[model samples]
Target: MDRHKVYISSTYRDLADYRARVINFFLSGKMPDSFSLISMEGYVADDIQPSDKCVEDVAKCDIYILIVAKRYGFIPPDTTKNPGRFSITEMEYETAVSHNKIILTFLADEKQVFEEDSDPDAALLAEKKQKLLAFKEKVRLAKLTHPDGFTDAYHLCFQVQQAIFNKFFTEIYASREENLDKIYFCDRRSQNYTFQKGRQINKAIQFFLINSHEKDMAHFFVKRIGLECIESDIRTLDLFIYPTILDNSDFDDLEFSMRCAIKEEWNRNAELKKFKLKDPLDVSVEKVLSVMDELNYDCLIISWEIKSFYWKNDKLNENISAFYEKYDQVNATLKTSKKIFFIGTVSYSECADMTFAQFEDKIKSIRYGATPIKLTRINRNEIKDWMTDFEIEDNPNVQEKLLHDLLPGPDPDFYLSDLELPLRNILMKL
Candidate 1:
């Protein structure tokens, strides 16, 4: 008989360090000797591509561990190259979903959730952005009914092992009576119930000013599941993060688009002080630097086109040195890793060679330590491509029906015939 194999998947930013620690805890442990597990870190010696190995591992393994964190995984870092591929974390989830593999997920932060009615930032990222929120809803529902969601970190390892143990001992080897005792999992507890939101919620929610009322929702979920029955119910859990930026300003379309597409967290400031300026260049750079100082973020995602103008300003050529000086000052003060990812070309028509060339020159001038950096230029071409993919995956029929049914009249009309030519045509025909 073959042993069941398990594979673990995670995003490296924000939660990778913690995930590695958890994996190590399980890897360097006293196991039942019969059980087996494999991970991405294990395949480094084989020279196998991480994504390929992950696909293979998920295919072979009976179970997969998805470390759901706030950050989306990286794209190839060069959107000018291949943009059709999946992020590392997304590839893992997608593979598991397609293969129908039993995925055992651990939600890193459960308290944070998408507020359905919030004003959307950047109309461009709305589609991908909405998908992320919907995914969270599904995971939240799954956690409410899965065994893995209820178990503590200590017992989580034991319970997963015990599931394997039951299959071998009871299924493979015939036993007279079922292990009924194992089914009724209960620990010594004098108190009826105690609830506390995880630490990730506290740290993350602070930046967004998410009120206590929002934070307290996690406890409500725990209560609904019931302490004793929580284990028996939940089978597969999902991790989700409600993302926000500093200054309480909504995450911009560019930031939202990049973050959601890649499934990585944007390095955001906790808060920023106001510095009014007449020049757009001065205002932008000054605001950026102020936020960077407040947040202590090592990485900065500069708007490629805007930053280039500042670099090329004739009057501020000497003064622009001050901008570079401030950048250096921040670099010197950095205590942790400072990696940057640049976003470019939200519209494909804007993809002039000069725009990219200008961006490249500006990027080269910004000095930092030997930090890993990636520049993603998302012109109209990429947006159309992304839009096409989203259209395919997102069941447009359901939405269409919903719109038709929910609207006031038989015909869903929003705009006049002449003004809304394209949209009116599509809506009317559909």
Candidate 2:
């Protein structure tokens, strides 16, 4: 079997733990035979320049996965051959571009900032941050599909899985193209509360706010809406449209990013080729609705991530509402459209001061008139039940032993944030 080589690129010391989580998934999780994740940890050698070796690895991969945080990373020597002081990560990106590799990019949310190069000088640190932000902007504008925020390890792996599946549809299934949506090919190995009969899923619900932290189990339910919405007969959502906030982008910028992702998706999809999508400089409500009117799918699932958006701040609201008229109408289409369902995740620190009602009132979001699901905490029974439901580990004694391994203080009740790392370790070996 020929597996896809996915290069995971990021600054090493800052995001070491994050790299480990995603690497574990591609190494030993459910589909290890089908895909492999490549990173610096895979091999070590001082015989070669790190930049040259990194670019060499990127050239071999079928896909490139780039995760960027606040660090500008190691700067290789500038020479006449390659004349700029680009970070090794940037060099690998250039290699990917030259090779025309399929790229899936994830940017860190605003709250996940790292000090650049362990610098103590505040002025120098700020300047390096500007460089990082500039690189992020370059990455965003260069691709038809915009880069998304990295909320958690599970979301990273799932995004990679979905993106690869969509891009290499024929290769994954040995050219059985019809099995695209019909197949539920992998297990839900993340620390999600499932496998019990207690979930009250509403298949008809098309819009909602998920009041869960991005680091917790909310992502699982978001993916569930895409997969398990049985009443709509959607085997799987046709495309992923993630338009996230990054750097200094305003609300209008976010909308434009979303439109670009959506337009590119429809234009690229063979079945949806008849309908044309247009890009206009001015985002009028009419133009947005016109795009919506062109949507021809029976059902579609779209995910939105908003970070560094202080909804409760009157000053920020003032800046946002000026552009709100157009977005208000555009979001309305998704809210009422029978063919669409959306899952939204917001930055935790940004919204901490606001209540649910405050969020609803200030954002005027697509979450209007829908029930939000909270996935913060789960008990011991849910974990054991999830194991049984997926047949991950069948023995009862083993289940308790694993629970002890997963949580702290000998308590079966655990926060999903606390359970994520250990559970991912188990799933890697499962």
Candidate 3:
């Protein structure tokens, strides 16, 4: 049998983990070992200018999987000013699309998009916001479709992931004879949840892999890629579109409280449901929603905080407001969710006594039992102790046992923050 070839497309810095994940998936023998793909790094080493390899690899692939994430701009070679028009990832995508290989795309989830307006530095944030806007435009034009009608860089990734799954899975059933006997593909995404997006994609992937040999398989693949590309390109979008707050102290206590709430919920529901915790320090709105949508948890606790100071400068006011707006937007969005507990706070260290009081007063006005929690009087030592106990590392033997049960080659390394030390430092004097 002729080995099938796949080529991956992605921004090296932003999507390195993604590339590894995809490559690992294939290498793990989930698919036939006869299948092979060009690693993005390997392709780079073989190209004329190193950068041009992405373009050429796409042209060569039987299948091209594009990993679209938040950042998709030209990565410069140390010095900045030469041939600055296109990014390596974008060029690769264009190459695949123009020559028309079977292109499958996956967008990382929205939780990956980081907002910079809350940065303590003013000049740095202005530059970041400008870049964010540019990246937003690029993503908006790239997504094939979006869920909840959002088309920002975050949602774009989700849509691409799903579309790719459908395109590839459906194509496989049409071409491969070996998989003809396979029935009832596993839909891990929806097996236990109300949401069908994940299940649909998994089914699609199963279909694509089964029918890999049909001569016209590329035709179906191309159609899916083109439609998604065009759909995202026609509309401009922004995922995080809120005003900035000028204070560093914004959302301080709120963030901590929200984290505590999430921890509480994780202990209760996630453990009961046998869900392994990925992020232990904090939980966001999306995480809560995912927990709910999947029926993994019945309750969620979330908190928000601002770490800013007033005396630093007025120039940073806009950035501060923009950061504040994100929390406000999130709070407003979760106003009606009775299952989710929301908390907000402003750090007293960065604000004047009067300003801190005013901030607390403002939060008191929120309708859904959402109000300022005055934790400033509480010692940082108390919070540190709580977090230290909260993020406890799993017992070393537990990981070994899980691996032993699976019969894997070796036990995986589990990262543990030193409970003896503070998880992280919170501002005291600011």
Candidate 4:
């Protein structure tokens, strides 16, 4: 196994003990593979870490581990076009990002971080807090890491280890390019409409009446279906996401608009890097049919965040009507792929709040007189079933815990808004 060098970036004084524990964790050889650690603590310096030297070390590492606490750390002189300069810790993070290092970030909860200066000048302290907040925002925006929160060194270490193994080893071993014909999946998991989430995404290709998190669930099913496609050699799975539209003016033709929008998320999504994607230039009935020709693709997921187009200027509304009218036929015409879909999203109040009869009318209006599909909502039983299904390589008993702790009361329906935050919290546990 190649020895992956990991760089640790954080403020020094308050985190000194935590940093030591992490260094010891690496030194103890508990990791599945070989790893080398690089930290300022090791470089014979207490607080005199030069920004240039720190970022230089960051560029040399294979992985970057960032810890954010209360302090913003020492700021160095302006460099590399960064306005108002930045802390040495943040500079290291920026360097790691620029060099494309795999980053895992863990944040300390407010209770876990005690301000060393209990009473400082209000103005100076406020300035520091603002800068720290801005830096935390940067970390969250980067999306290079999930930014799991931790309360203590042990919790941080455990989660960091879990994140590392899940991202690298577990993924490497769990996902093999399998020949699905040889290995069979349960009928429930097969390439059919049995999986509720999978079916919802496939049938309702565009427009999720979900109040919150339009594509989060969509992405989940897409990945799950992608796994199914990999298992069976029926047909290669391909995903084409017609990126999120910003404003009408931002729309640069149909094809390039999607491509440009996709670039913003392209680096953050590893699964997307594996997709055999295509850019559709034409929306006409015949050209779309030609484009949908299944040369090698079998299972395909097309998620176009067409929400902007639905509410943009009158011209766009007309264009969208014509566009959906043409592609609606392609949805009916495409026979080669096992699954092909488009999914848009909106506020729950805006879409699914009405009665089913009213919803059907709304759907008919949006879909131009075609048959409508029922919006998927989660129930208590499904949440229980999902918790029961949660299994992790690092912790096999995690499912039991999740079932006991996360399983909600027996509600008949849990809207998308209801479960999104809890779902995120559950992932943090992993």
Candidate 5:
């Protein structure tokens, strides 16, 4: 029965009808009963000052919605030296910003400006217009407002509904439970590979599956966690992924091949058949961080090959180094608040290419407050043995057995365990 408080701020005289329409839309048709609208219409009282009441209400609001038209409504009296200069609407917006509330601004089309016979003097009107434009520019520069224009009350109502649904409903109400954990799996892979049932699941294949079909994997991860803690208070899981993408030159063909392989594998399993999947697409780190802030993710899982950290070319090395530095900053900022699992894979040949010192330096640079789980080396002899067994093995179940042999077991390396213990210690803090 929890409700979200929304404060509507605007120059009332010109936008009165538009405001009424929007409030009606939310109260009667668009939103659920849990949304409470706060506006000037509801603050009328005999003794209380309207401006003071509006500011107080805005401070308590969870979301702030501002509508701006051509007219600059009545400017409230200011007690300071700059008295009667700024509109009450502007004051409400500043109050919302001070409280760090989620603000959404809707700019009305200029053509729909309201006309009044008793309008303010010409100079005052021009100054008000300039101030409104300046305010719009400020909000736009902050990247906080949408670019769409509203021509009528109905159009404005529709825009408000869309904004509410996208930002509030999906990101907040739909997954609001404190017991629901949001987990993201970021997979940076060179190619897509298939997995065999009995054979062990390698890091590359695990990354591909986790990133490409996160919804399905959510169920799997939740079930696995449930097995470990039967009486835990956690009740739900929300999974997300950052997918892999090839450059333009190599994308078309590889994407098609990956699709076919995925379809074939999915068709073979009944449970997977019930699930739908799409090709994974690359996303920027900024976008990932934005989602984390909005959804309040509980954990993030990132896996990559060791070679991805190495580059023979100086420029490529610099680029990778810069990326990790930015990544380190972000991780440090959120370390105390969230749980992170970073897994690195090393092929036997790759490990042999570096001395102990070189390998140790690589590990130190990429640790970034993460539990670095190193996959066991895969050697040529093991590959040969697997190929030889595949030819002679008659049971269809041999593939599953081979997978079990190859995948990392429950116990990781000592270093990985050392890094994980501290992280696990803080998981129950929330």
Candidate 6:
């Protein structure tokens, strides 16, 4: 097994016992063999600068564990350009943050006051308490999640074990990659169909659906998707649906419905019930690029009705064009390793002599190295036939099967296999 180096950061004098307990917990037989804890106590050399060495160790570590207690720790001399005076512990955290290390923070229980009345410097003690509270508050407000509080060394040990286990499960075991496999599904319509297709490939893929529609519709879609995943026998899945609503009129209700759906569906699966499900993240379509950047998605699957992108000279159609333009720009700026897939479909009734030409031109305009797979003219009769043939009871499953049949294969004229080959190749690699 590949070993992971975890750097421990905390006030040495105040949290020495808690830190020792955490280290010992990992060193015990219960912990996995892949993890090894590192702290300043393990450092034997005195000739090198302590602060520099701390930063170096933090940079090299695979994970950073920060424990916040009552003390502010020993403030090292200001040797760098940073204006704020940070202790050796804070410096280690800053180094970890700068290097973009995975940080796990454990806060000491606020009920227990570590400061003693017999302390020599009362004012200094008060200052340290204020600093510690402020630091804890700062961490709470940060983007990182899972900052837990512990009552004592035993409580801290259990919390540490749980946190590390959850992290390893989601980040490593779930994806079977160095980093989590994040897939962003952008669609104005219900994404249950798209999700069905995605699961057919990799059920373990993390899903983040961005729906630019009404809150009620988003709730309906999320509920449907959750139920489908549950019924499909997926043992564990990380799913998040963000509804892009303009107002907060129905946000609360939508959130409540989504939470209920997740809780109920997840309860049906014993393995999935162990993991905590977060509330639906609300975001606008305009912020899609920012969300993509933040999540660093491995694959982006964008599905849209071909009619929506048609040049109708209407404001909504123009907005759709602008959306693709932004997508093109974002894709151009992204690293080559990031895969972008465009799934375009048109109904048989919506198709015309100029439909193919128009769709081809629109795809070319939005082309920034995105693999475009245009589903051949689909009709109600063909869909019904497919559903009957496959004996699929669900509409979403039928739709997914129909779309899959439209992909390039042995048949050439009926499917755009040439254009879909590249996208299929990428999906296969994933």
- The lDDT per prediction is 0.36, 0.57, 0.39, 0.52, 0.46, 0.47
Q: List model 6 lDDT by residue over 6-43, tens digit each.
A: 88887665667788888876665444467886656754
State every prediction's TM-score relative to the real structure: 0.32, 0.52, 0.34, 0.43, 0.38, 0.39
Model 6 steric clash total: 1
**Global CA lDDT computed for model 6:** 0.47
lDDT string, candidate 3, 238-312, tens digits: 111111233343455434543554455465553324544455464565654554656543333233333323324
- TM-score comparison, 2 vs 3, better candidate: 2
Q: What alpha-carbon RMSD in Å does predicted model 6 have with respect to the real structure?
A: 21.5
- Which 10 consecutive residues of model 4 have the lowest summed lDDT? 179-188
Please say which candidate is ahead in lDDT: 3 or 4: 4
| Model 1 worst lDDT window (10 residues) | 204-213
Instruction: Choose the strongest candidate by TM-score.
Output: 2
Candidate 5 C-alpha lDDT tens digits along 1-430: 7788888887665677788887875565224456887755865211124577887899999989988777555555555722636667777778888899989988875544454313348877677777778877776776646444665675577578667766754544244332222111111111111111211222111121121111111223323333222234322222322122222223344334333443444334453334334432323234434444455643334433223223222433233334444444554344233333332232111223455455444444432222332232233233334334433233446534643443234233222112121111112222
Greater lDDT among 3 and 6 belongs to 6
- Single out the weakest 10-residue window by summed lDDT for candidate 5: 183-192
lDDT of 4 by residue, 334-403 (tens): 4433454444333122333344344333334453223322336565555545544443212436644653
Q: Which window of 10 residues has the lowest lDDT sum in candidate 2?
A: 191-200
Error of 1 at 32 (Å): 2.5
lDDT of 1 by residue, 37-129 (tens): 675675421122445666667777776666554444343334443254445555666678778877666654333331222224455245435
Candidate 2 wrong stretches, greater than 4 Å: 1-146, 149-206, 231-240, 244-261, 264-271, 280-298, 308-339, 347-367, 389-395, 398-430
Cα lDDT of candidate 2 equals 0.57
